[model samples]
Target chain A: MKRALRLRPKGLEKGRPETKPTNDAERRQLMTAEGEVRGELRRLRARLPQVTGALAASADGLVLASETDEAKEAEHVAALTAAALGVALRLTEATGQGGFRELLIRGESGYVATYAAGPTAVLTLLAEPRINVGRLHLEARRSGARIGELIRGALERPALVPRKPNRPPSLAGP
Target chain B: MANTETALKEATTAIEGAVGAALVDYTSGMALGTIGGGKDLDLNVAAAGNTDVVRAKVRTMELLGMQDEIEDILITLGTQYHLIRLLKGRNHSGLFLYLALDKQRANLAMARHQLKRIEADLEV
Candidate 1:
């Protein structure tokens, strides 16, 4: 199965933290256009009673958008999730595990469900204690396909317009 | 209660002293639906803990190069029994239903039999 996220060499230059998209000039761009993505994810979250929040993060730990108040911290979680995915994918491949599907982390307070949106993005759903597991999977699975399409579109070309003010290209450069 | 709700309720009621019955995503250790998880026993922890069980078994299978899927996993404790049933459906992958039962009050065989039936009729 094709994975939603890919692992690059450790030494590869990573992109800078995403600039907040604000102005119409930057908002018009596709790659950095987070409004639509965030809206869709928000809608998806609404459908899943178990999902307290949802976010789409790049495999490299860039937070695209999130519905939770802690959207900013999504970057941190994404980075660790990316690392785990890298290890899990490699292990699956080395031993001939059929395909990489989904990744999950459970904590004392809640559950984190990660579904591969494509080779570049992961859709994470955070659920409270009452969240239904079966329903979440069904819901996240649907959103994953949609999010995959959106992310894949964005990745087709790097968003040319910069969202941050007068930022040097070096920020995006490796 | 609706039809689905009725089914779930009936299933839980059939098992004497059923602590919790959840439809869990083994791939992500998320419990889809849970009934009867009290403050003392957190279903979320149970779901995540069983994830390790599923992963260990899958990894062991890989090491042995065995390609068959796991049907179910049964963990027997002194006072309770944890049953993990992998839901096998075209749309259902990396998912399972976890049921915890009081050992003294539960009939293991009956619980397993009923779970299989519930799994078959599960919508997702």
Candidate 2:
């Protein structure tokens, strides 16, 4: 079940081969950060009467942590958030808007919301249609900021590693 | 049953001074169908870009604690009126209909009414 829940960044795999080797370690750090964010999400859900679920995901659509029972649904939401983020960023830039902030979709059953978490991640929440939008935004914006910091820290840690000199090409071909 | 492509075509022809119309998936930022766009206005780009406007308004509503559903979002340029109508049907979730109209020749109220009618007849 855990394996099934691992979020894969299918959209970015093609251009990021160099980041592969450190994936395991980076994933560990991210998971730790995610754990903290998950705790925050849980608290937010507990305080808000209408929130049904919450998730933190990377900008590329990898799920960091989720506070929902339906893992598959969370995965799909995260991917969609990433896709939405792409267009949102472009829209803001093109229109002279400051930055990509948040997105909300209202349906007959409920509301789906996404907030920018720093530069590296996003926070998505699902809520009952009757939920208080003001309170949801207040708590969510705070939580999203913290999660963003955590993720940004995790991403920056890897940069501190000492770089090894490029190896000389082997003279003999096997 | 009416389909997305037919509905878009009908939107451009039925609405006066319509430059283009499109069915867009806000989730994927992709246009499912488009009609009537040319060199000055690109329906695909407009469709994709408007997803943000829809998203921003929704977020603002959440922040403002407003509970009312959005009927439609209207953007008026010097020569154009961009109308975005969110699809409320079960299967049409996350999708919206976007129509760009020439301001001089289009009747805003009637265009909105027609778009609403078109939205009801649209099948995904």
Candidate 3:
């Protein structure tokens, strides 16, 4: 029973790479996976020069993958982004707005935009002034839908921890 | 707003000295659109500046651990009233439509009701 409630399976193997694709096959697989889902962020980048980075993160703020050096800080960004997402989600529910779609952040140097990627993940982008923001937004929205499909696929997998059978009660115990 | 154009136009005309009427997103400080911003009042600057107001208010609510949502935020100037209404619809989260009206000509009750109507129709 304790095992069933645990978040992840206990460790038995350790040789696998911690992150990212390491070879051509894996890279090709990832690209194909995204492409299959119609995740075409590359085209968006071509149209928007200021959109320097794009990434997808889990609802818990775990960085899935990103195009920038900020991958190392993805967790932190994800967490804060999740907080904002939570607020946005709730606001939509409370107001009868239909559904929460996206979030936007603007600063002097750049803009950070996030969109809902299915139920369990988010797609985020960092854009500067050089790009056509409107075009970037259009592309990002399409990519967000594809990312949502990817996330949904990941979420459909069985839980890592297995459940245990119920134990019979002991007569002697008080 | 379900009838943003009508409400905005009415607000501007009815109020004796309304400088502007705008629907702004507090999170990004972007005006979805605006009406009545004159040379003296820049709606863009107002939108950006008001982001700080929304942020500070939200931060304060967090510090106090308040679970209630902000219904409306009123900023009172000597001659002006800056009214911020947080949208309730799922379509417009992290956004509040703001209206600036002159203190003398505007009726607060009518303004609030009209603003609510406008919020209902805003496309976001």
**DockQ, cand. 2:** 0.02
lDDT for model 3, please. 0.63
lDDT by residue (A1-174, candidate 2, tens digit) is 001111224464456441233354555656767667888789989987579999998767778999987999999999998788777766765686655678889898999999877755788999997665655666777888887777666655544445442221111111
2 or 3, which is superior by lDDT? 2
Q: 1 or 3, which is superior by TM-score? A: 1
Native contacts kept (model 1): 0.11
lDDT, ranked from best to worst? 2, 1, 3
Winner of 1 and 2 under DockQ: 1
Docking class of 1: incorrect
lDDT of 1 by residue, B35-64 (tens): 777997777767766766787798899999
Q: In candidate 2, which residue ranges exceed 4 Å CA deviation?
A: A1-24, A156-174, B1-124
Model 2 fnat?
A: 0.00
lDDT of 3 by residue, A1-174 (tens): 000001111142245322222333323333334443423455556655567877676555555666655656655677787677667766765786645577888788888898876655577788884333444555677677777666445444343444332211111111
**Model 2 scores what on Cα lDDT?**
0.76
Listed in order, each prediction's TM-score against the native is 0.47, 0.47, 0.41
Q: Model 1: runs farther than 4 Å from truth?
A: A1-31, A157-174, B1-124
RMSD of each predicted structure: 16.3, 13.0, 17.2
Report the CA-based lDDT of candidate 1 relative to the real structure: 0.68
In model 3, where do residues sit more than 4 Å from their true spots?
A1-174, B1-7, B14-17
DockQ of every candidate structure: 0.08, 0.02, 0.04
